[model samples]
Target chain A: MFERLLFEAPDFFTYYNVIFLLEAAARTLGMTLIGCTVGFIAGLLIAVLRQSVNPWTLPLRVIAIAYVETFRRIPFLVIIFIVLYAIQPLMENASLLTIATIAICLVSTAFLSEIVRAGLESVPKQQIEGARTLNFGAARTLWYVVLPQAWRVILPPAIAFAVMFIKDTSLASHIGVVELTFSGKMFVNRGFSPLLGFGAVLVLYFLLSYPLSRLGTYLEKRLDPSRRS
Target chain B: MTHLDVRDLACSYGSEKILKGVTLSAEKGEVVSLIGPSGSGKSTLLRALVGLTLPSAGEVRVAGKAVDYSSRKSVRELRSQLAIVFQQYNLFQNMTVMRNVTIAPITIKKRPKAEVEALAAELLARVGMEAKHDAYPEELSGGQQQRVAIARALALQPEILLLDEVTSALDPERVNEVLDTIRRLTDEGITMLLVSHEMSFVREVSTRVVMMDDGKVVETGTPSQIFDSPTHERTRDFVGMILKH
Candidate 1:
């Protein structure tokens, strides 16, 4: 398997197994994008709920916190399996892919909520006070002053989460979603070399995640000029 | 009879009291200077006046209206006519100098863009920041940022401006630039309440200087009376210590 990358890539391209795995990687990427968009929106709502100080804020805060803690404590594979098999029976007309997407999205939102909350808290109190003294209302202050600064602080963390979510898309293969990992399994069972099939899947995961990881690093550097030295 | 009056004001956070029974008054267009050692509730007093923190006891009246901390309607009206410039120069780092000055007018005040921009440009020019209208706060020096902060406050056209040690954070050479801008503002007859460590500037520019120690007013008098005629030992000690080279 180690020598395969150096000497066998040209041969692997001719095989049907390699093509099947590539198709699966495309499916995985698609699932990751859909899941991330849904989760990101949900996370934003959760973060806002947790930060709200109104009377209803306490119950929502508790629920939001519990959701994050519970999902984060459970394994990703178990969550996906439960959503695809157990929850699917109750959710009439829901596809396996849809159920898997919802499961991943629910888990991702918890992590994103914490990241965004920390970001929102990092903004200086003086900035908000300065806004108030200038006649800006509460909503205006948060939208114009606090959120911009918060987004800057949260960018790297958000990008890191995106990368993690991409890698975790492999877990969707457990629900018969035919994602990259599932495709690799199919190829291995069809009498192609197991080493090549698994190796290709590992390569696809690395390819999808490495660029995002690098982007996270770049974003961190761009946001903080004091770190240039 | 008074434009602003604070009676028995006490503000607390958690178990600790920050301002204890702070009572004071200022007439319209009067520049009152609050001088004290660090953490003597000078800033806390100013915050209470602006309704940033609701007083645990007593009351604050600006113009004819008492600032209702519980009512959003009253707080909005009071804050609309009041502005604060912090010691740390809290300019919006992401905004240009011109946008920083105009944001309040455009968003909170809901004025036309052409009007706000023109007004912003005039205010920026007043602060000698006409050349850096498009520059962000991070692009400016500390003194320049503070000057922009003053311009931002002025753009709101507040009746009273609270300057919390505006030039204290600047370098020695840059401090004069900010102080000079503030000094020039005195000619406009704008009411100002300054909490500062620059003794000479306060003595020169203040209509009245109120000295505070241990969260209580020690003396309130004209700069001449306070600086030349010592009434209290604490006042004398504060003046003497600050005046000595």
Candidate 2:
């Protein structure tokens, strides 16, 4: 195995094609930003909606639950394929990249909603009463009091999820989004060197992800007042 | 006029009752202190008055206005007339002291920003927390936090104030600072109904003293009468036990 892998003397220097690699990395990062931003906001709405109790809001709650459960159960590959092909014809001049980004965003949103909902539940019950007696009507109470505290608990998990969602952008290749993984594949085909090209891609993924993971840990500790000395 | 009047109030959790047939009243400028052993339904009574816990069969009148808690609009109107402080202080952990006191007036009441901010500053000053307006709740001691909670409640300028075991969570030394602040409120004439375990503070602050047990009011009297004279066997025993140490 070792002989076959290292037998040929190859020019590893030519792989420094800065323009191609930089362009691919930029596209990958851009899609990740779009996916996480849209996904977090949409997911937060769905999570809050799922907890609604009013008669008029009951249908919305049911729809939120169904959306979260359905997206979570189905694989992302299947979701991307469905959006790229099945839903493609219904669109008016939408690009393949747009379809793939939507698929990734939808799946990430389902998982994000569950994380956010748990954070909301972890807030103490006394706070609701505290707001009530202060005459901060129900809607204002939630917007001003409950949600702000919930954000402290929700942020760490959401940051952790954003790191995972950035990785999941690789799966967008099924719909031909030309993200990081697709760039690696193109590099390998053109250079006839799989290990060097793909290995660089793997290292790039780590470089992009490690800082965010560290940031998430640092913030989780900072946000928790009890943990600080 | 009666500032707070509760009639035959009853509340239960699941099949077990927490408050049963409890009725009480306080006139304007009165400070009524509820004192008894733990699990004596003192706090339950205060919570029910604020509609935090719905009464199974009862009515609450705040300053001559009947409160129908079953209707959302009525509950909102009734709440505007009252404010409560809890044993845990229950300050909004995410906000600064200034925001904690000013948020309701600005957001819910839609009062002018300058007006609400001025009132908040005044209330915080009254509670001796003006210097810490920029501080978060976690930065303060338990006693300090409770003081901020009181200021927050007072900022609403409610007709009636409910304080549920406000001193129970503090250290022995810390309790007096909070009691001093409550003493100042007594002079402000906000018509307070408070639950407390400190016998001396209750005797000093309250216009009327109520002893409760098993979710029922066992006795009600002036502080001097309740403390110096024994009206009932239960009241005597409770007052004696708490005053001993």
TM-score leader: 1
Which DockQ values do the candidates obtain, in the order shown?
Answer: 0.72, 0.73
Candidate 1 lDDT over residue span A1-229, tens digit each: 5674556556566767566767788888888887777777788788877767777578878888899899888999888777777776788898877888888888888888888888888887888878877777767887899888788788898999889888888888877888888887876776557788777789889999999899999998887635322
Candidate 1 lDDT score relative to the true structure? 0.85
Off by over 4 Å in 2: A1-17
For residue A33, what is the lDDT in candidate 1? 85
lDDT of 2 by residue, B116-152 (tens): 9999998888888889999989899999999999999
DockQ of 1: 0.72
- lDDT string for model 2 (A152-229, tens) is 788899999889877888888656777778878887777536776677678788888889999999889988745533
Q: What is the TM-score of chain B alone in each candidate?
A: 0.97, 0.98
Q: TM-score of model 1 relative to the true fold?
A: 0.94
Residue pairs with clashing backbones, model 1: none
Candidate 2 residue B97 Cα shift, in angstroms, is 2.1
